[model samples]
Target chain A: MKCNRTDIDTETRLELEGALDALTAPEIRPIFDKVVTDGRKRVTVDIHKVTMIDSSGIGAIVSLFKRIKAEGGQVLVIGARDQPLAVFKLLKLDRVFGL
Target chain B: MNAETKPSDAGEPTVTHVTFRLRASLAHRSLAIGLVSTLVEHVKSADRDFRNAITTAFGEAFNNVVIHGYRNRTDGMLDVEAELGSDHMTLRLIDDGVQADLSSVTPPDLSTLPEGGLGIFMIHALVDEVVYDSGTRNVLSLTKRT
Candidate 1:
């Protein structure tokens, strides 16, 4: 998977493409962690190009959501599709993320 | 050359072969699913039982390899192969990664509600048989009988 970082003022947007699975979760984790540490109040993760997600990928997203939410920040996932979207729906994370 | 054929072998049933070579990374999981689903759909009528069980098992096994075996490495390729027969289907996944000692790796105790440890258990539960061979490479083989 490929990830691009875009920061504009207070919102940090992480745009992701390709498959978010076990192999690529680590590459994106540190960025989310840093955003949380930087005290960003609103983070937008763009998954427009993402085509699939598995448990590990879901775990990574969940970890980021938890961390950012703990700091009273909001995390929004945009443009999730196919299996990744099914997973979020299955786990009821859609309600949690308000996506 | 196109017309040359063995008449005796013509009566034998044809077996479907499917293969995919994808870089062992999280982003390829969707590709794997798409490929596997196509195979399942192709053989569903002939081998519904095997198709159902194997489709679930493949999801779990492929997910495990893509997630745990590759872990942080996104450079290696994962080779996936599946064969459909009259009575059964078999899936073989090959990956180059740090092979965990299958002997040393104990099955996670499922009674405790461990979060990440349920993958293997779920794989075992979904398929008729599951095998893991750890050596220079990690190869997972799963089979189901229809």
Candidate 2:
């Protein structure tokens, strides 16, 4: 996954591309964690270009959500489609994220 | 190609299957998906939802074999056979690896938004049925209705 950071006054948006699975999940886990730890006020994750996502990818996002929410910030997941969207809907993360 | 199709002259639905053995490694996960995708694609009449389910569920099942059953061991054996039926798909997965302790593998509580324990849960939810047998060899039979 490729993460492009956009820092704004209210949020930090990471435009991620490629497949998020067991192979790529590890590479992004630390980066996501650091983004939260660095006090990113609001997180917007764009998964529009993500082709496939497995449990590992979902785990990284959930972990990121937990940390950011605990730190009094919110996470906004945008533009999820296809397999990734189905996964989010099945797991009911869509409701959690209010997507 | 193990995906031999039996065509019937009497208007019977043709049954076809393709089999491949995979090294139980994460590196082979994409190959597993690609193999199943080809099989799913062969069924041209199936709708988008059905194809998507088979693709996602098969990926989850293959991941379990490699990550949970084999525990990332490259030497572990996982044999995947996928069949394209007229209205559904069947995947027979045989793995020579450590047996999964099924008793502990239960559905995750969705209220908690747990991450790690959701793989098996998602697999069960996405597929029509999941049958697991453990003995001399571990077998996971997954069926998804198209």
How do all models score by TM-score? 0.58, 0.93
Clash count (model 2, backbone only): 1
Judging by DockQ against the true structure, name the best candidate. 2
> Each model's interface RMSD (Å)?
5.0, 0.9
lDDT string for model 2 (A1-99, tens) is: 687888888789988998899888999988897898799979999999998899899999999999999999999899899889989998889988867
Clashing pairs in 2: B3-B17
Whole-model lDDT for model 1 versus the true structure?
0.68
lDDT of 1 by residue, B41-102 (tens): 65545454444446545766776676667778778788887766555566788888767533
Model 2 chain A, poorest ten-residue lDDT window? A1-10
DockQ versus reference, model 1: 0.13
State the displacement of the C-alpha of residue B107, model 1, in Å, after optimal TM-score superposition.
Answer: 15
Q: Tens digit of lDDT per residue, candidate 2, span B107-130? A: 778879887877777778888888
Per-residue lDDT, model 2, residue A43, is 95
